[model samples]
Target: MCNTFPAVSQVDTGASQHRIESAAALGTLVSSTASYLTVLLSSPAHASASESLSRHHAQVLWDLADIDARTAGLLARILQPFLSIGILLMIIRIVLSWYPQIPGDKLPWSVVVKPTEPVLGPTRRVIQPVGGVDISPIIWVALLSFINEILLGPQGILNLLQRKIDIS
Candidate 1:
């Protein structure tokens, strides 16, 4: 007698694939939402000093002296990644500039010395580089990170967003 076994492969399990696709879509949505919000929050016109103050006033009166928790959470989620990426980019730029050797003339305007009238005789004391010491990049990285983490991190954005939403 010949006995035939049932094929287990014929059983369809489409739910797993659907779940994975749903998860991926959700991730994309969250990332995009965060990015859009970050751009809005960081915009010069939107986050201006005057605008921020107005927003703070609205939040105090309208939101019952409290900010919306959901908005705050979203801002935190978006800003953390953005600030981290900015730090990473700054680090990369610093590293890249170290090897190519940027020209002294091409140095940022802030670091460049301005020409001034000579006080003694017909000569001026031109600023000269005495040695090879470029600490600006290090200082920049430290300052940027400090600003992002301390000043512009969770508290700042949340307060700003609260003010904005409250005003509008």
Candidate 2:
């Protein structure tokens, strides 16, 4: 029993000594790395190089921003006209709906009906015809108009972006 107790204490002491040595080595390594970093950061040449890199980085960011603004503005200009045309076409479709005599299969009537039907068909499924009249065209008109007003309107996204770009 006495021999067993001394063996256990020896093992415990050895393990504790190993742990302390490992902790001291780790601390020394960490402090050395921290001092190296501190020295590199404090050097005047390193500071100037970092400053120059920062200036270049800022210029690159500004250039990228300018390019993005130009591209977005161009897309906005193209999309605004497309939205307006969509509103115009939807309005024409609504007016044509009033005339029952116009044969839908014929060339002139087909032109309007063909383009508008794809959009109206899905809309009809969601919003059924009311009192024997397909109100899909009206719905599309209101939707298109609303979209046009929201996206390309006076205080719209494109306009706001253009203004911001211009001001900057």
Candidate 3:
């Protein structure tokens, strides 16, 4: 049955070969440590045994504290919102794209032709072409990429790891 599929057989054999030794070593260490602690704690000399157990417990707690610190630092680095500005810009652009323009009501040719005063009060008459370019999306994506790759990329993970190790 095992030999029927060569790929499966090979993978099974390889996995067993590679992992079995490590698994056995880990199991042995765990069992031995547990047995030792149990024996140490269950000894008749309660004071000495309690002190030893407390010391071992404290060491374990310290190790766990270090691990937590390192993990938190790594997560902080990885989860930093580098693309937030770009994302916000993109959202604004999307909203603007959906904006409804004011409808122009039809009027007499004379009224339409005549240059009316700007309704919103005094304004400079800059002869800009109607429906110019909208490059907000492009700018947003470019900025997002820049921030993600430059400001937050190299330093994030490395700095996180360094800080974690340093604190530990």
Residues 16-48, model 1: lDDT tens digits: 111112333334434544454455567766437
Write down the lDDT of every candidate, Cα atoms only.
0.42, 0.59, 0.42
TM-score for each candidate, following the candidate numbering: 0.33, 0.54, 0.25
In order of TM-score, best first, we have 2, 1, 3
Clashes of each: 0, 0, 0
Estimate, for each residue in 1-168, the C-alpha lDDT of model 3 and write its tens digit: 223222222223243221112333334434554666777767787556667667665543332233233444444455455366445545444344344352223343223212222311122133322366344444455666766654346564334433554321
* Clash pairs for candidate 2: none
Per-residue lDDT, model 1, residue 70, is 57
- Highest TM-score among the candidates is held by which one? 2
Which ten residues in a row are the worst by lDDT in model 1?
Answer: 1-10
Kindly report which residue stretches of model 2 are placed more than 4 angstroms away from their true locations once superposed.
1-67, 166-168
Which scores greater on TM-score, model 1 or model 2?
A: 2
Kindly report which residue pairs in candidate 3 clash with one another. Answer: none
